[model samples]
Target chain A: MKIGVIGGGQLGRMLALAGTPLGMDFAFLDPAPDACAAALGEHIRADYGDQDHLRQLADEVDLVTFEFESVPAETVAFLSRFVPVYPSAEALRIARDRWFEKSMFKDLGIPTPAFADIQSQADLDAAVAAIGLPAVLKTRTLGYDGKGQKVLRSAADAADAFAELGSVPCLLEGFVPFTGEVSLIAVRARDGETRFYPLVHNTHESGILRLSVASDAHPLQALAEDYAGRVLDQLQYVGVLAFEFFEVDGGLKANEIAPRVHNSGHWTIEGARCSQFENHLRAVAGLPLGATTRRGETAMLNFIGTVPPVEKVVALADCHLHHYGKAFKDGRKVGHATLLCADRATLDQRIADVQALIDA
Target chain B: MKIGVIGGGQLGRMLALAGTPLGMDFAFLDPAPDACAAALGEHIRADYGDQDHLRQLADEVDLVTFEFESVPAETVAFLSRFVPVYPSAEALRIARDRWFEKSMFKDLGIPTPAFADIQSQADLDAAVAAIGLPAVLKTRTLGYDGKGQKVLRSAADAADAFAELGSVPCLLEGFVPFTGEVSLIAVRARDGETRFYPLVHNTHESGILRLSVASDAHPLQALAEDYAGRVLDQLQYVGVLAFEFFEVDGGLKANEIAPRVHNSGHWTIEGARCSQFENHLRAVAGLPLGATTRRGETAMLNFIGTVPPVEKVVALADCHLHHYGKAFKDGRKVGHATLLCADRATLDQRIADVQALIDA
Candidate 1:
């Protein structure tokens, strides 16, 4: 089988790595000629909107999937006309627009932060009056890793929010005060059979995920799965769907959803029964779903911007290092390390050791 | 760091997969341009004895290692003059010849089947008389997976055995009436740090490895490790070395050794804390040795000659499939499957399911 990935990043690179062992080939369409995953398989360097390249990819592969939700939904729709695309272009269309995503959450009776679409300054002011202070203003589409979003702490902050956001189409969402943030990765086959990995607690610094630890038996696991199940059923989704939620008063409030494989789930490569990458490929390739049971205590640390000394990382016991073979740049995710420990105590100690090294 | 490999086979393919995540680059020297591993990294399509290509590879890599023992020791010796090579050319020199390997085993007080060298038909007759009836004759070098060897069941069978082996220099050895076979994979670092994976019980059909199960607390574990430790110390090995032994009356008898990664150790990919491939790369790259604790009960099944339907294999729970991407041919190793289970019963059940598929 040949899989065509729409974005060539770490996730695509990992997908190729996982799929190759299953006797699957890959072709990636990306705008950057030097995308980190280009070395792994066929990489067609062209803009996501390049109809010619998208057509070429669709013509070559048996099916199509994407690494990130930022790829234009229209491109997916264009490819879907010629070949099968997993998770459906409708999933992409909804995930890219925060308004569509949040509205769908409300329509399905799933709890989410209060929000309203903002088309202009007047709309922003009206939303603030109804939703109250400390709300967040975000562009409805093409935003990720904390980009294209602004926080309104008070009425004074609301006046300039629209101007600061380049006056683009956006949405104003109420602040979700919670104790923690957890995300669940759920995979659905075409047959509608669904499964989920355990909820993983995530930590972010300046909008980029820096740490994620698999939380076995977290009190909110069932609630998170319930919310995710509602979304997957609503979309009749096929492939891995990641949903992030805020823990408010011991209940989950849906935050956002990514219609692709997620960074927070990377620990599955070595820490779970079946890796998310392989499972995603399985779903899109029409293979039976794999078990999602957690193996043991595990934690994943993202190596943003720069990779640490190879010898030091390799020296850490039970630590597995992954470098993306990417050029170093500030705030870029160059690599990550996954640690497998026998118990929570050992997992904590190993995470601390890695944390100290990264902080230094 | 860049590592150069001496052969391009499944072992080398796996080594590259393990090394890529460690930020290491690779360049392989093999005679086949269509080597299965060619897609993984730089492929130098040239004969093993091509000094110019060998020199180019040595110049590009920070260190050198190999995937198979059939690679000539002199080729390794020649490359050593340009770059550092692991397992030492001396280790390969002794391992490639049956007479030298048996002598060294005897010198180290390791028990092996009684054997004698045959120079001619007269030598074969005299050796059979000395070693006893029901003996086996094999070439001194370049034989694997039941090739280039024959057996003498009795006086009537002795006449044709010499003629069957192309009249090459041979070794006549007594047959070991052992209960079973097992193999050990051990890694040693430049700093003298050593670690061992748990021994694996092996099943072979017509001398081709068919199945291997990680046997925890097997009665002969310590004896196998002790024997392997002697060889590592003697060679002062700096990478993974594999030792096969025949289980005789709950004890162990030494068989031949492989100076590189062995097929029987493929189970370690998902069965151990760190795989044998990663450990080999760590040793050659001068990194710390990883923990060898078994994850759980596991079994590996080798796919020979052809591959079964991929979807059927992927449907098996907790079963991981691997394909070498080589054109299938009779008697060729095409791939393998590793099944991880929580207990012996579950492991056996899963292995039986996969076994039925391969047998069909």
Candidate 2:
């Protein structure tokens, strides 16, 4: 099958890699000609907003999917007229806007942080009054990797936060003091059969995902799976989806949903029976989903800004390092390393070994 | 680094895939425009015998390697002027001819079955007389997967066997009663460091490899490793190499040497710390060779002509299937499935499951 990907970033590159073994051809479309996915497939250098390019891409491929949420919903909707877009334009629309996504979650009886839309200064004040201090004020759209958001510690911080965000529509969400953050990577087949990978406990540094370790220790692992299943069913999602959540007071609260395979699930490439990208392809290609069983306890550490020292990293026998063919940039995800081990203790030691190399 | 591959079959396709994560770029030269590796990299369609094309390929890449030994020695030597070819033209020349290969093994103190080269009918008669009855006659060159070889029960069968192979240079060898056959997949770095994966006991039917399972029961496992190391060092080879050997009377006798990665090592995709393809890329790209530790007891079954039933294969839980994108032809290698398990018993059951699916 010829699959068209709307963005040509690392995720698209990896998706293309996964498609190769399955004999799936791919065309990656991006505004930049040098986008990473170009290395893996035929890359079309055209803006997502270019109707001609979208039409050409839609005409060429059997189906289309997006690499990121910021891809215009109208583009996806228009392309849907010519080719099937997995997760649908509706999923993109909801996921792009924080308020719409949270409201959808609440409507579906899924737990989410209490949130209120704020359009004006008066509305912002009212939201703060209702949700209280220390709430997060985020732009309604185009936010990722902790961008387009600010934490309002007090009434004094609210005005500055609003000013920083400028005229963009926003949402105020009451803070959930969670013990940990975890993400569920799941895929729903065309037949509505859903498969869930083990939940990954994510740790972030400087607002970027630093590490994610797959765990069965989450109190809401079962509940998270059920919630992801319901979400995919409601959306009729036909590819990999990641739902990020916070474990607060022994209950899970939805944070956000990524409509495609996610960074937190990168460990699956080495640690799962079938990788998330491969499973996503299987779902979209109408093939039966392969096993999601974890091969062992695994951890994935993001190589942001710089590649860790190779000598030390390679010395750790179990670590599998994947370097995305990308030039280094500050805070940019250049690559990741996954370590697979028999248990948590071995994984922890491997992680420490990798971290020591990175620090050096 | 930029690496050039001289062929674009499944082996080159896999090498391209393995090179991606290592930050290596590849250029493939092949006469087949639609060769599988072409989809994965910069493929230049040119006849192997064209000197201009060979020189252009050599000028464009840092190093050149052939996916198959059938590549002419002249092409390798010509390219060596501009770019290094791993395993070297000398290795290819020796390995390509059965007579030269056996003589070289003997000179290197490697054990082999009694053999003699046959150039004409008189030479054939003499070889048969010297080797005795129940022997095999094979072409000295261009033979693989049962092609260009025949077995003789007695002197009465000699004319027919000779006629079957046609008027070609041939070799005659006395048959030995062997308990089993095994192969060692080993890699030699340019810096001369060598690493060996565990010896795999291989089972063949109709001269085509059917299955390979790792075995500790083979007394020659250690000897195979040592022999492989010595052979690679003698050849000064740099790349993954497979050596086929026979077990008879509790001793291992050298059967043949494949200068490139072999089919028996396909299980490394899921059954080893790093796959043979990946390690091959690493060695050719001047990167550190990865650990060759086995993940678990593993078995690989080749999918010849038709794909095995997916449902039955998937039921084996940890079995991973890899289907090469190729037109199905009788006795052609279309793909393979690998099963990884905790022990031999589980692997035996998995193998049975795979065989049943193939039989069905």
- Supply DockQ values for each candidate: 0.71, 0.52
Positional deviation of residue B122's Cα in model 1 after best superposition, in angstroms: 2.1
* Residue pair clashes in candidate 1: none
How do all models score by TM-score? 0.97, 0.96
lDDT of 2 by residue, A250-301 (tens): 8899999999999999999989989999888888877788888788999899
Candidate 1: residue A160 lDDT (0-100)? 83
DockQ of 2: 0.52
**What does candidate 2's lDDT look like per residue over B1-360, in tens digits?**
678998888888878777777666788999996787877788889999889988889888889987888788778888898888887898899889999999988888888999999888788888888889888899999999989998988778896566668879998888988888999999988888889888898999999999998765456778888788878888888899999999988888999999898899998888999999888877775668898878888989999998765444544567877766677789998878888888888888888888888898
Model 1, runs deviating above 4 Å: none
Instruction: Report the TM-score of the second chain of model 2 against its true counterpart.
Output: 0.96
How far residue B49's Cα lies from its native spot in candidate 1, in Å, is 2.2
* Best candidate according to TM-score: 1
In Å, residue A324's CA in model 1 sits off its true spot by 1.7
